[model samples]
Target: MKRDFAVIGLGRFGGSICRELSMEGMEVLAIDIDEDKVNEFKNIASHAVIADSTDEATLKDLGIKNIDHVIVAIGDNIQASILTTVVLTDFNIKKITVKAQNDYHEKILNKIGADQVVHPERDMGKRIAHNIISNNILDYLELSDDHSIVEVKVGAKMLGKSLIDLDIRANYGCNVVAIKQGKDINVSPSAEDKLKEDDILIVIGADKDISRFEKHLVVDE
Candidate 1:
């Protein structure tokens, strides 16, 4: 089934979401107060309109109630972001995700009933920082405040060690969810499978445990 999505605010973050959803063959209504921004997405989105999302009447006129998910990605305008979210909540949208500018914005969004709040810039910074800190860490994803999933390249310490020999779950408190070699991925890697150089391990665990696992196994001394 093709899900219906509405993305308000046509800034970089919102624009990116609109593009991705449309590319995935979902029905998307791209909304923005800017005429040029609306025009830019006219060919990409299922529908694009220059409408103020903070106005309840305008949203109702756009048939926003039919959208399965709404993303409020208003850039910098905290007032508009909060007001739009409040209006969406009043309409009982099934899922409302908001882009938070800061911690205070996130708190308000959560209190106002936003289902999910994302910090794109902050998250990208963290990913880049992780990539820079270690040559082995290829990517990082934050699952919660204290938990994360990371992609770590199989380093010298991990080379030739089988999953049983490492006993990662018992020793490091982490799980090897998958392993990637070249372009192929083993989603269910066996316990006897041995690690090879340049292979990537997708590990998930609490932040401290992941750090410990990385320092002891993935990172070179």
Candidate 2:
């Protein structure tokens, strides 16, 4: 079943998420105080309306409480974002994800019961910096403050080595969660599996451990 989503504040971040969710065939209700922004997504979203999400009556009228998830994406206006998120929580919405402006804003959101808080600008910068620092890193995803999941291309050093032979977990404190070779992905890759030079290993571990693994085994070979 397609999930129902409500995206508040149709700025760049929220707009992008709304469009992607709609394209994926999910039911999305796009809301914003700006009529122009709401109208821009009229055909794209299941419903688009010009309404301030900070207003509890307006949210109730729109049946927002029944939505599976709500994204508070108010841009620049941190006050409005907090108000909207608080109202959503009061409504007992299943999930609430909020775009935080800074560390202080994120802290407040977390304290107020936001299910997820995203620092898009800061996180993207970290991801891009990591990618540039390591050419072998295909992708980087932050799981928490200290842990991350990275996709690293197998280098010459790792080529033809079985998982057991590498002893990745014991040696570097990282786990090879999956291996991708061309279009095939081995989610349950065995200890006996050997890595090809072209294989991509999806590794998960603490950020420091992943950095150590990448520097020693997946790069400069």
For candidate 1, the TM-score is 0.95
Mind giving the per-residue lDDT tens digits that candidate 2 earns over 198-219? Answer: 8899999999999899888877
lDDT of 1 by residue, 112-206 (tens): 99999999999999899888878999999999999999999988888999989999999999999999999999999988978999789999999
Q: Measured by C-alpha RMSD in angstroms, how accurate is candidate 1?
A: 1.3
For residue 119, give model 2's deviation from the true position in Å: 1.6
| Clashing residue pair totals per candidate (backbone < 3 A) | 0, 0
Computed on alpha carbons, the lDDT of every model, listed in order, comes to: 0.95, 0.93
TM for every model, in the order presented, reads 0.95, 0.94
